[model samples]
Target: MATQHPNALTRALAELPGPLPAFGVIHIAIPHTSRFTVVGNHLAQHAELSLVAIGIGVHIQSLPVGSLVGIKALTARFAEGEMRIAAALRELEAHGYLRRAHVRLANGRMATRTVFCNQPGALERAGRVVVAPKVPPAVPEEAPAVPEEPPAPPPAPEPDPVPESHPPVRVPPRTAPKPPRRPLPQPRELTPELRRTASAILADLRSHAKELVLSEDDIEELIPGVAAWLEREVRPDAIRHALTADLPKPPKYPAKIVRHRLTVLLPPPLPGAEELAPAAHRPLVIPLQNCDGCDRAFRSREPGRCRGCRDLAAAA
Candidate 1:
């Protein structure tokens, strides 16, 4: 019989490792009545997923698991840093959209495999039974059936002697010890002046850019750098100018952009009194002199005589 050829779509589908469920789209459920409420619920609890999570999620959804994109690549693609990418991934894992497992390979090597599931509970169900790579068991050639002998006698159990008891040995039941409570981290104390300066800088940035949005944590992190800038006598307007200069149209990731600009434009620290001491102690440069006779100006070690004039005077 002539073999029937598979169509293009069928061939493409067959080449895929497994079925593609949603084709290329991820559906986010939006409640008809309480849309904001549902979004706010996620934002409040999963703060790490707030800022760049949607972008990262969309990017990951487009690619297959075990694709060769690294953290650096993701950072470049999202225009954020490795920390942000890592935090977003952690958030995804925490929310059960992503999972990682070390699976044994056919070559006796172990490799980490990442599994992305559209449904949250899929990973949990998958965890119940591990599906490892199947290696075919080596089959030996079938041997001729052997005739078995059926007449073996069973051994009888021995009778127990009376047990001698000392006092009933008291053994305490083992119990797991309670975990020690971790000490709470102390809140970082900022001077009122530093706080005011940082607030002023942040306020100026907001006023200038309007697009820059920084959270309380972001503000706290940026305060020390702004404080240092203030210490160097950098003006507030300069800070604002530095932040908003050359901004992209409809700026994306404003916090990162602002932070990057602020870090890059921070004025170098002023030299200390010790650094100025050598220059201060150096001998002063004497003013240049013109010889009365020659009218030629020269640097005068001794006042008012050029070398020629001095030589002539010495000759006389």
Candidate 2:
């Protein structure tokens, strides 16, 4: 026994007996540079055809080898050896369906190739021309607007929650503290030298009141004697030697022996002699170098002798 041959509604559709319905599919293989018109002419002359998907640079997932695809009047280029849109038509072809081809052309220029196919149906399987089923006109439906819930039923009248409890507490008021006081200190006493200078200044102010008032300056000059006294006190021996050296002659008295001679040279107060005692006394010996009767500290005719001593020596 021989195996049965497959029915081809798809193959018969590829070779249409008349003009194509407004919509159909096509599948075919085309040369690289062949225009869409060649493919479309082959379709119009042979296969039934209609609408297809369209866009420039559109991409398809799978295809039969050497088949051209059409999107609307545009003939999509085949992927060379791969068939496009065939994956979508595989099951239909398996069940003995027919396919149609159409080529797109405009202004005598080829645009794209197309393929047409029939959906499986009782009329198609029975091998007779059947008109496509007409779709019923669509009816518009109006929806009723729903009323919003009445403000959520006034929040369900919630009861007041119980109050919280805690123990009572107290805080004391604060007061500012005062600063401690420091005692005032006493003044220091003035020194003796400072007191003396202050007294002298006061005396000057009193005495020179008019002058100070006139010029606001109190200038007090040192007395000449005070300066001399200071010089003498500071250099007593120098002053004494200078005075003695400048005198015309040396004194007859030995400064140390004169005091001792004073008593002997004077007599006690006598009745009548008291008045004459001072004058009657041997004229106190004033030492001279001329007088030899006394130490030779003074110059006189009689060395170391006074005037009286010289007279006594002459009488001798």
TM-score of 1: 0.28
Best by lDDT: 1
Question: TM-score: which candidate is best?
Answer: 1
What is the alpha-carbon lDDT for the whole of candidate 1?
Answer: 0.57
Total clashing residue pairs per candidate? 0, 51
Residue-level lDDT tens digits of model 2 in 94-178: 4323334232333222343222222235435654322221211222122223243111111223333221212111111123333
Model 1 lDDT per residue over 1-316, tens place: 9998998766645554433445333222222321111112233334456557655654554453345445777877767889988888887778866566565544334777665444455436644322221112222223233243221222233332222212122112224343343232222455788679777787667677778877777777677767666667677777777778778888878766766566656677678776778876977797788787799998866667788988999999
What would the TM-scores of all predictions be? 0.28, 0.14
lDDT of 2: 0.31
